[model samples]
Target: MHEMSITQGIIDICEQHAGGRRVLSLDVEIGELSSVVPDAVEFCFEACSRGTLLEGARLNILRIPGRGHCLDCGTDTPLTAAFGSCSRCGGYRVTIETGEEMRVREIEVDE
Candidate 1:
């Protein structure tokens, strides 16, 4: 699974940004359309962080709802999938505005 690689990237980010400090917690945002499983990532984190600075760091995940702009209706609407039809006009010509987000949002470090 790519979650392992992603978790590794998170560990790298934490190490690079921690700057010799002890990381206490990490917050990440996962979008509905991103296709990244939070549980899988968490499992990977536990494995990948072993013997590292983030060995016992708390992981906080924020889920972001997918949103799209309907070209036919000129309205922003919620989407359950990347290719979901717009609610206003039942149009398939919707452009994704948000969602598909996978990134670190915050990190807490011990002084």
Candidate 2:
């Protein structure tokens, strides 16, 4: 899964920033639309963190719900896994707001 690779990348970045310090925790924001499975990512975290500064680190995943704005009706609606479609006005043209992000929101480490 790509989440494994992504987890590895996060560990790499954390290791670079930690500078030999022990990683206490990692706060990650996973968007619903990002297609990342929280359980799968968490499962891979331990493997990815092996021998790194983030080894045995606590991984905190914050789920960010998908949000969208209807362009035709200007209605803000919660997005489902389905394609772009306005829930209020039934408009087909919808602008996605947030919920497509996957990023390391914060990282905690021990000095």
C-alpha TM-scores of all predictions: 0.97, 0.93
Off-target runs (Cα >4 Å) in candidate 1 are none
Candidate 2 stretches with Cα past 4 Å from truth are none
Error of 2 at 78 (Å): 0.8
User: Candidate 1: lDDT of 72?
Assistant: 93
lDDT string for model 2 (22-99, tens) is 999999999888888889889999787888889899999998888998888889988875376788988878777888
lDDT of 1 by residue, 1-111 (tens): 999999999999998999988899999999999989999999999999998889899999999999999999899999999999999899999999889999999999989
**lDDT for each candidate structure:** 0.94, 0.86
Number of the top-ranking candidate, with TM-score as the measure: 1
The residue-level lDDT of candidate 1 at 78 comes to 99
TM-score of 2: 0.93
Task: Give the lowest summed-lDDT range of ten residues in model 1.
Answer: 14-23
TM-score of 1: 0.97
